[model samples]
Target chain A: MRTLYQFHGGVHPAEHKQESSAHPIVMAPLPTQLIVPLQQHIGQRAKPLVQIGDRVLKGQMIGQADGATSCAVHAPTSGSVSAIEMMPMPHPSSLPDLCISITPDGADEWITRTALDYQNMNPGEVRNRLRDFGLAGLGGAVFPSHVKLNPGKLDKVPTLILNGAECEPWITCDDLLMRERAAEIIAGAKIMQYLLSADAVLIGIEDNKPQAIAAMRAACAATGFEVIAVPTRYPSGGAKQLTKILTGKEPPSGGRSTDIGVQIFNVATAYSVARAVLHGEPMISRIVTVTGNVEQPRNYEVLLGTPVKELVALTGKQRNDTQSYIMGGPMMGFALPTDNVPVIKASNCLIASSPSLFPAPPPALPCIRCTQCAQACPVNLQPQDLYWFSRGREFGKAQEYNLFDCIECGCCDYVCPSHIPLVQYYRFAKSEIWAREREKQQADLARERHEFRLARIEREKKERADKLAAKTQGSKAPAANADIDPKKAAIQAAIERAKLKRSGVTPKNVENLSVETLKEIDEIEARRTQLKQAMEKQSDSPK
Target chain B: MSTALLIMIGLALFLGLVLGYAAIKFKVAESPLVQKIDAILPQTQCGQCGFPGCKPYATAIASGEADINQCPPGGEEGIHKLAELLGVDPKPLNAEHGVPKPKSVAVIDEELCIGCTLCIQACPVDAILGAAKHMHTVIAKECTGCELCIPPCPVDCIQMQVVQEDLTTWKSKYPLHEIRNV
Candidate 1:
């Protein structure tokens, strides 16, 4: 086995994973209602093609992707669309979002799904099928899987890295997946390898999850794919970090693994890809880790878009005095405001802990420059400088210190003696900068529009003035249009000068037409006309 | 002469023992909390959090050295949690955690979030919603109060808001605060 490449800094957080990994993936009994957000994936908000009263078959595309960046929303269970309007989404603000409220018929029947034989179909076809099925990255990313599968240049594809490093303290869904569905996961890796035309397939699992690692290894034994165990570290599961650990390649700053010819897919997403390609599943359900201070901490095969309340209830009620309910794990999870919100693609763990189990935070003090955070950082960034800039709202400075590089893994906050919410400050600075930039972009667009409008108006005014002057003077007159032009006379003289130069002809010397010159020409013509007229008039008058 | 030297040595050893004991006896109990503040930070090695990582922040918090509202990703929630933990009165999420938007993390519309990871670079808490041009998501809980995510959202797909709730746990309004250690 090749030696694992370690990143700079990471914290050894308490692993609460044993509580759930001990158990197998259990299926939650069907709920009466499934509230699926139409905009579950990170993309264009899905457009609802089904009405509130319409009946939908399981796995049917209820909502279509509004644009390329979006995904299709499918019915997890056969049901009637209760509402196609905005309802509360599982977010930190508890905001209302577009959702499909399905009243399950309880049949759990699947709609018609298409399957392509791998024997004949190419990688592109496989990708298109997944795209049509609305498959996405299921490991909390919820990215469209089809797009990731089809890198622009297949020939330059790097190793296909399967991430099974469930490094968060309490999340065991991926571990459970590796244990229960190892074959499927390996199959998925093979499919990804085929899709990307990867040279080799590497699956990275944390050493702590021995069972999962063993299972994955066993599954990969027959196949040529290799599964490697990595030392457990908080956020070792991060894509960039995992990529670096597995391949010894650092994704370029603000660049992707694909940019360097590598593509990393979460174990779950790989499994889904395999199943979707092999079994024709449409990503209707996923394994969720429903643990944390609940009565029964377990992992469940939850259908996509199930409401959090139902899932929590399945684990049994909070023991009366649960102080906080978090969605995801403790370190990186949000304290849920209410349970009415529906789980979306990224919803992984729903944690409800009593005050006793999860105590309230301690009071904070000022920074003593202990440099402990620096010691703990995995990315080798100077968090103190970033914090200084962030607190001062110097977003530009914070960014210069690689503010965007901070992963919010809670290691700094977790290790801080001062109890300062350092991540919050960075988040604030980043958001403020983004908001300001957005405002600037909007302002710039508005300015462009305003300038264009002014120019248009000026042009129209000039044209209107020209037309009015032409009308006032005789329209047929050569100089009529020139009356409105301030420089028309100069322009005409220039044209005459050019013509004279081209033809070698004397330019019309209007200056030579003096009073005497005009009088002589007029008198000479008058005398000749008078003599001829006098003879004719005399004859006519006699007649 | 030998006896006198022995006596002096004995006396010196006795005094050293007594001083050590006195020092140990006089030692003050370290605050239990100082250790906790260190444990909650993301420890990204990306030092956006003015402190080094979780431990330094913890030390500062325990010493009454740091405010509870510096983290941008933690936003109002982190501030509230810190305030609750420290027994300090919770203030509105410091405007500095960026405006406390709906707990929406950046979600790469897969089709939109352009995976340019401009959002990823913009994300102070690394809670942006995508990967490089692929879809990314904000680990909702990990996001700090900072909206640094909004800038790299090339497609304007990232939205910050609160996490969702349901009936089992969703109370129309939160219950009054009754501090219960258990």
Candidate 2:
């Protein structure tokens, strides 16, 4: 029996998972236009490969991965690239990002793909293929999976845990996926284990997901894999918290799981890897749980660039009282700016938000120094202190208290009796710190460049001075050898040149001129000679 | 009684000698308060604070000869930081010095530039690059957005453009809560 450990404070918010999981997953229809944001993952945004008016087949690479930390973006269906411009993205900030809007040709055709045999291919080759397939963590982080798989420079990976703990309320996409596709998920896990050479693989699912647990257990019965049922709690699915629960090791603050010889992948992510490796298909869609304030709430296999409004329309008619649309689970998800934003890889659930399902939070009251928020904090950080410091804009003090470790899990907000939006304050503080850090970096760069410019100017001045000094020395050397002062030598040379002119050292062509012209020239030379004699006499008379 | 008085005198002299030695051993050579104030001042060196550079302004503030609100580039937040450091009340920015403006960097029109080096001499940070009788251009990265180069340009070719914030530099403010109609 594998032992399960408990993590620090978690709340049991009413699990509203039954309504969404009652039905099997459905395939969402292709929308007329797919608006694919280039930056669907966490790292650098992908660069567009196809231009406007270019024809693209289904699963065609539209945006290529930019750097080591990014993943490729593909067209969800056969389509013509209509516009690749900045459009509204599915971010809480509602800011516009570069997106490729494609008009589907309704053919749903696919490009030729060849899956690599994992057993025959090298690990590096497998990871490269996964990156091209645009695989990312589908557990809401959407971090590129290829970068995570390499575990760069780590000699050994002792344990690989597949996270199936969909602990957030009102999200059952992963649960249904487990129940239906347990064999495929397990196969994906085996591939990951092969890649990492992990000694053991553990699949953790919440106790609330009994069907998923039974299915996963039956599938992994003979595979030497363990499927443990962890107690259902909000945010147990967080990367750190889940690792702590299954492995009894808390990844140190500001560190990664791989640092402790453990690596984790979302179950859905593993499934995608299995597909990409076996079926030669890229990650162009995901299971999105659409529930709340609708006639029939269920999970649907959603395409990457399908808009939220289209997915909501599939469930049922939304109640008129639907207040807003939230993109993920209630615990950690944010309210989407609008329904027009496309669903990217990180989108796991979309709730048709209504008043009863999510009542407006009561007015925030004053902090009474109640330590409840501190108790509920999963990362064991002092929330009240961070709150006060962030509210006062005292970023230094906030950082001193480990503000970045808070993770904005909303647990403090959930437990705060005073109704303080503690998570919001933490987010504000984090963003402020990030902005200030960027400003400091820019300032440092400017300072370096300015100093370099000053140094270059000084060097140029020295070079010019050295050249001028060398030229003067070269000119004076000849005068010094001739036994005359430099200035006197120059004056004597000018006088000799004047005497030559008076002597009429004319060219052959000039001597061939008419006699009248020759007479004029002789008169001019005589005048010049008389003037030179007068200048010399004047100089002799002077004191 | 005489023995007791002699013992007391000897003890007092020994302690005094120890105290004098300790003071000399740990005495600070320079006032760290000046350095702290200097770190807070935006090192624009624009002379908008009526000082030649940020170091002079910091020295004046440390010596209590100048108020902390004199730096316009630092603006209100800067004044607050200065006030906190000096344990003084935060004051509004001194309008006599200058008004706070959006961050800008000097850009020189290369086509219109006559290669005159007046702007180069005027730049406090030496952000402009050019020699006499050569076209001068402003190195945007090095410019502290001081606007000092504008007045000295003979051709009026230098312009200060507000830096546009892209996705990397832009930070979204905290979202306001929407009141439901119900």
- Please give the TM-score that candidate 1 achieves against the real structure: 0.66
User: Which tens-of-lDDT digit does each residue in A261-286 have in candidate 1?
Assistant: 78988898888877777887777788
Query: Estimated TM-score per prediction?
Result: 0.66, 0.81
The residue pairs that clash in candidate 2, if any, are: B115-B134
Lowest summed lDDT window (length 10), candidate 2 chain B: B173-182
Those runs of model 1 whose alpha carbons end farther than 4 Å from true positions after fitting are A475-543, B1-182
**What tens-digit string does per-residue lDDT give for candidate 2 at A1-543?**
778888888788999999999999989998878999999998999999999999999899999999999999999999899999998888886778999999999999999978788899989989988999999999989999988888678855889999999999999999999999999999999989988889989998999999999999999988999999999987799888889999899888788899888999999999999889988899999999998888899999988999888888887776899877898889899899789999999999998888888998987777888889888888999999998998898999999999988878899999988888888888888889998786666556554554565678899999999999988987867854777666787799999999999798765678568999989999999999999999999999969
Worst 10 residues of 2 chain A by lDDT: A442-451
- Name the top TM-score candidate: 2
Point out where model 2 deviates above 4 Å.
Answer: A480-543, B1-39, B51-67, B82-91, B105-143, B152-167, B170-182
DockQ of each: 0.01, 0.19
Best of the candidates, DockQ: 2
- For model 2, the local distance difference test gives 0.88
